[model samples]
Target chain A: MQHMTIRKSLIWLGGLMILAFLLYTLLDVSGTDLTPQDRINTFSTRFLGIFIEAVPFLLLGSLVSGLIEVYVSKDDLLKLLPKNPILATAGGAVMGFAFPVCECGVVPVTRRLFTKGLPMSVGIAFLLAAPVMNPIVFVSTFIAFGWGEIIVLRFVMTIVVAVSVGLIFAYLARPHETLLPVSFAPVRGGNWGIQPLPPQKMTLIGGLYRAGRIASDEFFEMGRFLIIGSLLAAWMQTRISQQSLLDIGSGAFVSVLVMQGLAFLLSLCSTVDSFVALSFLNTFSTGSLVAFLTFGPMVDIKSAMMFAGVFKKKVVVYLIVLPFLMTLLIGIWVNIWMMR
Target chain B: MNITKIPAKDAIKIMILFGMSGYLAYTILSENLGNYINNSRFVWLTWVAVGLFFVLGVVNVLPFLRPKADATVLLIETSSIMPKSWIVMFICALPLLLGVLIPSQPLDVKSLTGTLSTTVSVSNTTVITRDPLKRNILDWLRAFSLEADKTAFDGTQAQFSGFIYRNPEFPDGVFMVGRFVVACCTADADPIGLPVYAPQADDLAEGQWVEVRGTFLAGEFRRAITPILQVEMIEPIEQPKNSYLYP
Candidate 1:
């Protein structure tokens, strides 16, 4: 009863907050002159642009997650994955070649996999590597940079970062510590028995029907986060100038830090970020450009929000901080090494 | 077995999803998707999303109509609506609603100025063609960035179309004509332009689309050695169907 009361009050508070925001925006729109109106238009356009660009990917992710939930059995998943944690982590890193999903799509899919008895380390590895290690991103990088050492370096560095993060999770964090507390335990009720449905006996038509249902459920669950994440990202993109960061950071270390910071804030997709990074090659150091590509797909403002939906708050913090530090170290090292 | 009625809350949620998907589809069908996403390539992705949304909506609504169907077919279990979920649903729907009610317009010049810095960087690898008349604002910006001596571009004929922009610092009879070049989407778009000098420059208001036939001459703007477009023929033109230039 107390819990219900708290929830009710929270809802009312949310309602009031939203009402205030709407009223404020309306007043601002009506009260402002042309300049403020233009600002509003630009903000909305960017917000919607990020939202529209991400919707398809989010839909694809939910569909794939739905299919996994309905069709793939725990016994089957266990049978397919290696028993050794290190080998499993390595397997997760390269798995993206077969399943190419952007950062937005990877989160739901990773969450689904984690809940399905997959090892936490393996899940972490897959989440980090899949966005960059995939074929589509590889092809795009090749197209952007052509045949070169930078492409090779990017591939190597991504695998190294993913594997390292995976190993760190495996060695340090307990399996239970990595996942969210809610819904991690399997439910042992309902007519479907211990299993949702008899794994082998489930009909194709029934599986697809179930898949549709699961997709819709997952879409709403994840879609809300996507919207909020994209809104924040779009807001930052509109208000901040990339050149300001560039101007301040001159040395190799500062430049890498600045670039990684930009990468997190910009929240660009892995497949196309190479082209955007390419434009910076003239102005930014090579190491900084590399950091932008490496750190972005693994962690960003959008992905961090999505991660909060799946992992505990502490785990999400580690996920963000660890990658930033690791990527920065690698970036600075590369910068110094290349200078010789 | 009787058809299971979809709870009112669930029904509302489904309709909202449908409305959002429909708006996106409408935008694509109308070729105004570019107004939101600068990339033309994403149109097909929007089409796919539309199909998926329709499927999900139908699947969700079916359980209410089919009396004999198993109740488990409904993906979301009908439960009392949580306030948190309601807030999230509202957040999800807010953008789609605003997108529909508000008329679609290009990003204004104010946003362009806010996002771009005072100095723009151009790549040295930018290929400069022999005929400069075909070069756009981006092409000239690139040339200016890479050129060792700005005076080399003097007497070069140039023609391009872009919207007008002027900073208070810009001298009278001089204004910038620029376009936003999008690498992936509008979020990553960068404003690139060249300073144009004409007797009537001050007469043209900002954000007015214009076609300028001019000669590129090395000149100073904002105390920096930048190439200035010496306008020969200037005419007001309608904004391009797609205001953004895709790289």
Candidate 2:
């Protein structure tokens, strides 16, 4: 029986290898207009370099995700927030500001927090708010937007989207049932599974180390995603023509949608997307630009995957849907206000 | 009904190899194609990194899917991850890709008139010029309160280029409004305004791109202001194509 299983696994792996080889060949031909095996080594090396650079970071995120699975208890987290929906959501946004990590860094941490027993509302808020509303992100935005009437508006809009999403999800669904934590972390049931009743038994140092381990693991595991996301961003910058986007700069709403679309597709890093958006400054209105900033980091391809890994499929759907609408509304408001 | 999984370690070994293979494939593809596409040396390495990620992804899933295998073989495969030939290949290709992508910062031209072909020739000249000191003055204003130095001019040579911005406070004259220069993005964007000292203010209209080759005449009124230019020529150039310098 085991032999048969081995054979099938081998076959599965072999198929993957064949697929990789064929895809490589197809891409080689289609991309460079090159014949078979002409510059395959060169192409492979370039691709490998990107992966190598990203591995360290990916390992970090994964380890962090793993630790959170091991150490944090979810029950303790639920006690922090009120059952009331509005207060809970607002509390989530406030907690998001406490962490200074970017969206990439936030992924594992968030999953760990959710696993540890944080309420669904708070977890959702951390996911959305940490990327944009955290102190580090806020300072970056302040510097980027320039201190104008729009500065306050950007902050308010980000908080609104993050809090509203968290609150809506909290009332709509509970964390345990909604985010599919069951598959990832199967905690033992009963009192033994729970840390001893007296929480103060552990020293501060011990708790700090545990927290550090969890954070680092999260960093390593998700590092690859960041690397991949950044590379895709660079590719978009090089391959995708900006002129096409430039053509639709006439209408405010159309322009906002297009720019937001570009943000989603481009998936540029938060550190760099500001500059890219600024490049479009003369091309699009401020409102559209705001939409691009708010939407990109919140729901890029990678963050979406993280959501899938941690939350329930239903919650993931809402997580994606709500912020998108909120961003559009904010964009329109900014446009109308700017005109006035 | 009974498919075996590879041992966790062996699966990891395969993933590492797959990652390497993906890297090899990407490099070959890019070297031939990247140059023709608008390639940057800074980002050329990015493709290779991407390819490596495929290998990492392969490794990442190995433990989950690998059929349970023996410990000895897994150890051998793990050691094989680093061999002499692989290292040599990586070193040889990196510099070649970098050579093609770096040292060129291409400007994106938005105006029909502004777009210049990569083939456009620029002759190096010894002429010393700056965007304008008025821009510097405006930057100072942004940092500190705006103190209109009606008497701030010293008749010193100041270079400037920008659209004309009329200040309602000083309707008698106009200020040369230019966006501040930042290497990366608007996060660092600063604004600067230069004092216009031309005789016929109406001749140089707003939004007309021009190179001002005159000296600053520090004075409050246009009547007292003087602009000395050994070369006072106004030629219409293309509007600034890139709205922000580094977005």
Candidate 3:
């Protein structure tokens, strides 16, 4: 498996170049008569914007995960989380307060914890809940919505959707069944797993050094997925006119879908999304906005792409599909019945 | 296996990470960072980027200095997390190339698709008390959303700068001072503009940065009586380093 040679590096570069070329053609065919210079400049500005804004959080997540890997003993982590699957998954729903990681940061952190034998339900719940369930986002939403239904509904709905989805995974999935083998760290519940490496004898200073090393390596490991995801999102934003997409679907059911679609497409940070949702107050129903607030933080283009790196492709699909369907039902219910 | 023959993935990792730091620092230093993100909102984050990338770069170097037998086990474990490819390794390094090669331009007419929202409010109550003269395009829209009578904004001293834009819907000799409003990043930026009835707008080219010192009055704009800026003084200005208004 460790057969990578210097000659193989060229292939990666070649793959990226092909991607860039394909992106250029997509724009060209999308009906813009663009000078190549204009296309590259506009797309690059957007691509870098998302990358730069999110990378800080990504690094912070990597750093924390590295710290957790070194500082928190595996036994401590296991003890902290409940062994009862339902209780653990339920606890995971509101566990965002401790981590406070955003959608961009949560994936890597969850993946790291999974390696430490974090339960499937906890990881799944935290993955979905962390973005919306955290304090920063809560405060932001509060400021936007005030002490009212929108704010309370957003949180409750997020927890409901996240926990429901988490329990679904916990009931159905084994750790190995959904996780990448390398991420299956000493997880006993799995059919097979990697035996823990002998603990390194270390001083406090040594631990810090080891943490730094793990974080940097992880930065490279997960960082690539972020870049590619940002690329696709930026490209899509440049070509698709968001206003046109939003102008459609004013009905109770359809507006929820449209708003959810907008959330996925825009991929705005969950903190600022309430303000964006505030703009739709006059046009969209309460439920759709709820869906947007809940679904957006749970699944968006960039975060969805990042999820692919840690979980199996099928698990990633469930990660999206479950949250989407549940949020949609809740949102539609709010529109059709609650608001009425 | 010859240890020296294999290009140390560790060394490549260091270079790529350090390169990320260098690129990020370059953006911050070059003042072109504003073209990509709202610098005012994310200034601290850019510093975090510089520091983290630099720290990570240093961390990668340490593995070589003290290569213990147990470190090989780490090597194998870490290797499994990423796809086995030199290309995949380069993907993290992709931004360095894109940032250096592409000249980051602030969004303007080229990016403004469809009609810009003149009356669309973003619900920022904080700026409702701020002086209208100090308000940007977004603040003005938010202010407008609070008032039922459109004429409440009339005769208010309006002073702000944005790129010039006009659509087919715009009245003749009228152009809008458009600002790209970003909640997070350029990906979510949407063009918002206020109409300005100025004969001089005919001479001003699209996407040209200009400062408008005028008074808002209810006038015919986009086929509606909205708070149209009756331009008193308009001057061509260089594009600001960070042109986006943070919502």
Candidate 4:
């Protein structure tokens, strides 16, 4: 059949491409000087660094998602969510305190929740807030900035931004428009949306087996975006100078925009970004630093790519743009009121 | 020979996942984890991830080898493995391949060129300790970032170690001795150093790690009023086991 021929050709082509890449890598590695000065070396190292750092969190998220798929009933999840949309959004914003996941891990968990019939508004809030509003990031930020207004303000602004975004989704978008395709949805009364195993098949060994399969599936599905995202981030870090970007912007407004732009490009994990931001404390204004902290975990290159996997294209665009505008405005206002 | 039929795609996924997890565990066990991640705390997480991947991989692949297992159930379970999933799996495997194939090295002097800037103003509030010789390059850089007047550091003895960085704009006898201060990972590393004035500075090759024992003298270097190290001694040294300074 033509289909079989094409498939065979594609497999052969993929194998050959991988072989070529391996040979190239080996040649590069075997060279006498293998310092990170070379663009190829630097890019590869940083790319692997980001990927390696994120994998553990991603795996944890998948396991949790697997548990959700097996044990947490759809009706029970819905029952836990508040009836009022506003209350539900607030609940979502604060929910991350109890469930602390990094930006890399939050996407798959959000997708799992969404497929289990979680309200879009609440899911959106959790997705954005869970990265920064968690306890780990909170303590990290506190340690980095010390007992300062910046730390307190970061928390306040994060909750505000998350809740507002959630409210917007709740009031503006329809349920179907916000979610992924129906086939990708998690079916009720089944482990991972496959055919429900009989009561006899629902033993402990059977459940563990099902959870492992679901976790593996979810890891591969979400991991592609993480790889591509990290690749872009690494490329930008090597090619673009942070100083050049910082040099152009000086005033409160421009500085906020510049720092926010840097945050998006860097796509650093929330737990560690504060220390990096601290190095800039002397160079950048207070408000710009706040913007960097608030906007980064909410939307970054990596998170944006992950968003594309779960939400509609239009929804993804809003998720990126709205956060930029919100963070920029808040940063400028804070600059005028506090920095002065 | 009642072997259960497993989708070929699921088998491939298991192999890729298992391979990546194994590679991660190897990196940690080999103590090459610092080449990628700056934090030692992440080693335990990597171990846990390896266990998860191995468990999941074995579970997914076991059905195909078992005799008299229901083929119908296996087929239904493996139906989720789509043809497009191969692309995702390939991407996931890429970093692992790169880690193994490519030689690991720390960022070099070239990375410093783009990030270093001359106009960074120091605050006056930095508390300079009485014994200035005890500070590292980062400590000196921090003191430099805070010092309002460069002249205050004059005659202060200092000893520090870092790679040599030469700005083309500097005079023949001047070069910056710089080290990258990494807050989390290499991506966030920022180069910070002090300019040293040595009569034999031209003899030093860039990117070579060296220790400079010198006294801080107030002077203008490269058109900026900054504290310059009057180098009394300079010697080449092996790159430290942990090349990057953690904040």
Evaluation by lDDT, superior candidate among 3 and 4: 3
Docking class of 4: acceptable
Q: Candidate 3's error at B170, in angstroms?
A: 2.0
Candidate 1, B136-218: lDDT as tens digits:
77667766767679898889888999888877677878888888877777777778777889876668888899999988787
Model 3 lDDT per residue over A1-340, tens place? 3457655777778977988786766457355445656666777888888888889888988888888877777689889887788889878888889998888888888988887778888889999999988999989898878888788889999888888888888888888799877577455453121223346766687677667767776676678888877888777777778778778877888998999998997777776788778767777889999999999999998898888888889999999898999999989998888656
TM-score winner among the candidates? 1
Q: Is candidate 2 or candidate 4 better by lDDT?
A: 4
DockQ for candidate 2, C-alpha atoms? 0.04
Between the candidate structures 2 and 3, which one is better when assessed by DockQ? 3
Alpha-carbon deviation at A317 in model 3, angstroms: 1.1
By DockQ, the better pick of 1 and 2 is 1
Backbone clashes in model 4, listed as residue pairs = B122-B145, B123-B146
Local accuracy of candidate 1 as per-residue lDDT tens digits, A1-340: 9999999999989978975775455335443235556666777888788778878888888888878877676688888889899999998998788778899899888877776777878889999999899998999998888777678878888888998899999999976677764325542222111136556766787678777776776777778888878877776766567667667875889989998988888788888898888878777777888889999999988889888888888999988998889889989988999888
Q: For candidate 4, lDDT tens digit of each residue in A292-331?
A: 9999999988889888888888999999998889989999
TM-score of predicted chain A against the true chain A, for each candidate:
0.88, 0.73, 0.88, 0.86
lDDT-sorted candidate list, best first: 3, 4, 1, 2
**Top candidate, metric lDDT:** 3
TM-score of the candidate numbered 4? 0.88
How many residue pairs of model 1 clash at the backbone? 2
